[model samples]
Target: MTAHIPQSRFAPAEVVTRPQPGTAPTDRRPLWTVIALTAALTGLIMAGYVLTIGTWTVWAVVAMALITLTTLTLSLGAATAVVGLIFPAPRAPRPMPDWQPSSRTAILLTLCGEPPRGPAAMLAELAADLQRAGLDRFVDIFVISDTRDDKAKAEAEALAPLIGSGAITYRRRQENVGRKPGNISDWLDRWGGDYDFMLPLDADSRMSARRIRHLIHRMERSPSTGLLQSGMRLLPAETRFGQLQRSAQRIMGPTFLQGFSAWTGDAGNYWGHNALIRVRAFRDAVPLPKLSGVAPFGGDVLSHDFVEAAWMRRAGWRIEIDADTRASAEDGPQTLAEYHKRDRRWCQGNLQHLRLIAAPGLHPLSRLHMAVGVMGYLSAPLWLATLLLLATGAVPMAAGWMLLAVATLLAAPKLCGVARLMRQARGLRTKGVVLRAAALETVLSSILAPIVMVNHVVDVAQVFAGRDCGWKRPGGASLRLPTGGLEALAGTGIIALVAATNPSAVVWVLPVALPLVFAPLFIRFMEAPCACLMARA
Candidate 1:
């Protein structure tokens, strides 16, 4: 059944309308502080390099410029985390104990070709939670399926009981026109008007009933909030690689999110799933525009969440993130291959944001969000290039202190996060476990970083070559070797070149080089379950 959801009209204009005087003020001070700090750190590092080198060759100048840019990027993250440590977003007030939602919310579970059994179980649990909380009457569940194969039939069969009982409304589209965004848009066009708000969920997404009620209550109280994104924790992981990721997320994610929330304020981002959207605001503001070209940079906006958040913000609706709300969770890829496969898709989508970065009438922060999305992938190539330049001795290596400084900046965020976790650790025994896990994650992540960088560099190249990494279900987490052939080759080539010419520099490069060289072995090691670490995690 369709309801008359009034369409809101918003066009990208040449000039952005300034926020009204009384509208919730965005605190620009933290953002400005991050920018200033990043600039200062970059300048200092560059100056130190020049002073140590005491030379001005053409290659040296180019290397210095690249280092400056890389340093700025690295320092921006560290500075933001430090700022978050100093100025945490105030805790959201707890929902009233007896509060009842006044508005209806539809939870849209968008499924692709993923296994349906897991999602069915999750939905069943969600239903039970909501029912226990007396929220079943206020919320409806919809299974919007984009699965097109025999799996579609299987999915329907799996969810048949839920559908038969009227617990979930199921619809499968024959044509996956716009992919996930299209599936959501289809729902919005049809049933959006009947609900006050919609919660878009990924196949792996899970939210506690308390969190859902909290989000709904917040949305009801704040009339202008078009979207509210909750802080998400990674669900318990089974594989060693997944465990490492989960531990890092558990320890570091909160601090980074707090910093992110502080700086973004009302102009926050949407991570697609596990977020609440005002039905009318999204319907009116977030009409996905098919860009005027081909794959990657054109066609359907692949990374629609950020763009949606941006559009909603531009249309004068507040886009907020409640970092204090931490009950929402999602599953992550369990193996390196699985992780890289997902990253490849994300890489293309984020690269597509390059075209939207300059879209007119966007808030500067919105533009920054898009720019950051673009950089998230592009930074890998930049980092690879910077490493190559430094290793070849094209850039003077006299600045040992410069290397030390860069290392410090790179490690600062993790160190800060660990420190915060330790401070909050209740007992000495608990603190020790946190410290050990933090150290293990740090070391393993260092080994994995180069491999991931090479993969991302390849992903960026494919996008530029007009190759689309089409939406495919991630492979299962089965252990295999030779996962990093390209990484192995790259590392071998670098080491060979260095050993043949500048054998002395090989020692300095071993930390990064060894990881790439032994990537397959490392991948296997990472894939193997470590009971010690998993128990602590």
Candidate 2:
């Protein structure tokens, strides 16, 4: 017998009612402490710049401000890591041997134009996993497609076996209205009320049945919690670039995430996937509104997860992250070009948050969340400008001590991350391996940093110029000569100018300059496979 599905409203809310979750006092001391530390460090760097130069010209002042702003961002990260190290890690939830879900849940796998073989296989495995755990009856799998006719036909074919056995249902939308978020909304409008919860998974997202059960159990216990985000680790990678990223995430990601969770508390942000969402709460609170303008800033929100999280918080439901959930994972970009391509879309989406920072009724922390998102991308341009200002002799080179201080501040988080890993190591051999991997990851990441900075600067500039980074799949390992050439030119110019004008500054500029000059080679290197780096450790 076909069960009748209750439809839910899809209209955007004109006004938010008072939050049903009462305003319990959240301890924000850690947040304030981090803010104060960032400000103090920024001030110290600015003061050192003034003392070193012995004069404050207009250019010097502007450069100082930009440098300090970038320094502040870096310091905030270091401070968060320090805080993370201070706080003991959150304990993972205990397993419930006799637990059974009292409410229905759905697993939503949102698809675009990607090939379906992998995701179909993943879903099949997931279904099998759930059956093994004896929880398949309480959950349903939905393959939501936003692909064109060609891709949709392929997806239907690939998913045919699963559908035929009633293990999964496939649905394709005629219009890709709001992109991924729109696809989810369409699902909610049709069958949202029939399910108590929904676990949204991206095309690349993977979670085990045990992890899914853990998240559901957490949600079932916390009635006021609207969104429960799992800690996502990177899947093992084949390319050096992917390996570096995975290793870094494996090593350093935990402390940062722990600090972030401590600071945000119940008003945490969301990453749009691998999260358990209370269907009724999401339906009531997160019907995304179309912004009044056009692409980029206007129309549908590109970075909808954070905004939906903000809206969910405004409507008075707890949004939390359980960093201890280690079973959830996702694939990462395998090459520098692919990384930048994905980053460009994120850069555009984050920039869109600028318009909504001061939207009515948002919690202060939610507003801060949006501001943080905007600043994360904008920091790239600020950093690029600082480097350019130094190269042009607009600002005098920083004093040796000042430079050392800045480097230490930037490297502090990595040091803390490494330290934590070493402490957790059981044997001398394991610690030695951890140290070697850390050293290699550091060197490679330092070389890659400037390239990323330049890419981000271009992304920010293009976004402001109304260039829309449309929803497109990340391209394969193809060299972009234009991007590489631009980097090479910028690096060569910076080095030549600095060496000719201020010979002493050449050393300081080498880190940024050399990478830019050799960007094409570095890109190629990153695209090649290397298993010896941190990922192997």
Candidate 3:
């Protein structure tokens, strides 16, 4: 309900110039029609795939079984998720005090392979926010840059003027040690004792002064806690893509957060970036074990954050989430490609956690958290495989059963989310708008699944290969919307063909057939950003 305009005081303090308007919101209804048609077509393809399956084809049945089962699980999960109310709580943070902090606090802004000017803007914003709250000197800030790139190094040097101003301590290590974990350790090893608490901010992070004050006040009150993690949500900028992502996240994000918060009870995590940690505890857990010498699971630990949290918990320190902690907001993937590219690396990093879930000394539930992270991305591939299988001709009965189960489970959470959005939008007198958006999103997102899933699969592979997904280098790609229509039609065409094999299913096919026809357009419109920006305009 709390929507912000171009960066405010408690908002993201930086704003770019307005963009020239191109597409109008009124032009979006055709986009919706396109989506509906594609969904109906896709339903046909899927039906064909089911009909092709018979008792004779064993492999086909196996694929159908996996897809059907996974989708069912997904659906069941959806059904249980309440739409608007879920936000993960790390652990209750100590109640912040009304009084100011008596001790000096250090804010550590870790910069590794990020744009040089980026941190300064964030720092300026942070400084302004803090000054507004009247707590500027109570804090000392540092910019910890880990530069393997020459340009990044030069930018770090150029940042020396900011350092001279005494706003933040600037340090660039000669060699990159343990990535982010190493950077934080380097700072603590040298000058950690100078302050009471060291706050770690992300490269794209800009927090409100009020939240920052709240964090410091709480830390002052409770000297026992090692780390306090705040809630993190998406902040995509001005583009159509950005708006849709942000809207979708706000509407459906709470449910996901709630599930995550519930799972992490008592000893939670410090997600490395975007949370505050006790410098003393982090320093004590030094010399983190390297991932075993192997491919994906070997070398420097990509998921060092979770490992560090585990280590902290084992050391008798408590880690918790302050659900009320809205101190900072992160700039989400700015472009579509950027979003997918980042997801690839994340898939890799999280998939690696599957290996260490059983590591010695990890809390019993620690593995569960790690496992859940890994599964989230993995579900994409499983969904993809299910679609491909139902395309092949085989036992119609069993295939139909499996598909029903998978779709039911996987789609459950989203359906619940749809209901939540409907209520919220209705209360705001935007019921008509919200329902239309939901219908459009449901169809298009389904179609876009294949594209996203394929990307995720590639990313998982890259992780195992140790391919570096870092850097801001550019790549050439055709100016193309996704292959939504064709994929949807082909997929649903297969479904329809299968349904035709049995005269009885002909009537049943109508139920799914309509959505499948609209599948392609659905995926296209489902870009959330495009639709949201259009509607907003």
**Residue 485 shift from truth in candidate 3, angstroms:** 14
Question: What lDDT does each candidate get?
Answer: 0.81, 0.81, 0.58
Q: In candidate 3, what are the lDDT values of residues 277-318, reduced to their tens digit?
A: 766667766557776766455676676788787777666555
364 Cα displacement, candidate 2 (Å): 2.2
Model 1: worst 10 consecutive residues (lDDT sum): 1-10
Candidate 2 C-alpha lDDT tens digits along 1-537: 112122222233234333356454656776877777778777787777777885568887887777776787788888888777877765656657989887678899998888899898999999999999988978888888888866777777888888877788778887788889889998898777678889999888999988989889888777788998888999889899999998888778888888778778889999999999998789879788888888767888889999999999999899988876478999999987788888888888888888888889998879878877887889888877776676556676554565577678878888888988888999999999888888888889989988888878788877897877776423322234554777888789888887887777778788788999999888888888875644465
TM-score of every model versus the real structure: 0.92, 0.92, 0.72
lDDT of 2: 0.81
How many clashing pairs does model 3 include? 77
Between prediction 2 and prediction 3, which has the larger TM-score? 2
Which parts of model 2 are misplaced by more than 4 Å? 1-19, 23-29, 397-402, 472-483, 533-535
* C-alpha RMSD of each candidate structure in angstroms: 5.3, 4.3, 12.5
Compared with the true structure, the alpha-carbon lDDT of candidate 3 equals 0.58
Question: Hey, what RMSD does candidate 2 come out at?
Answer: 4.3
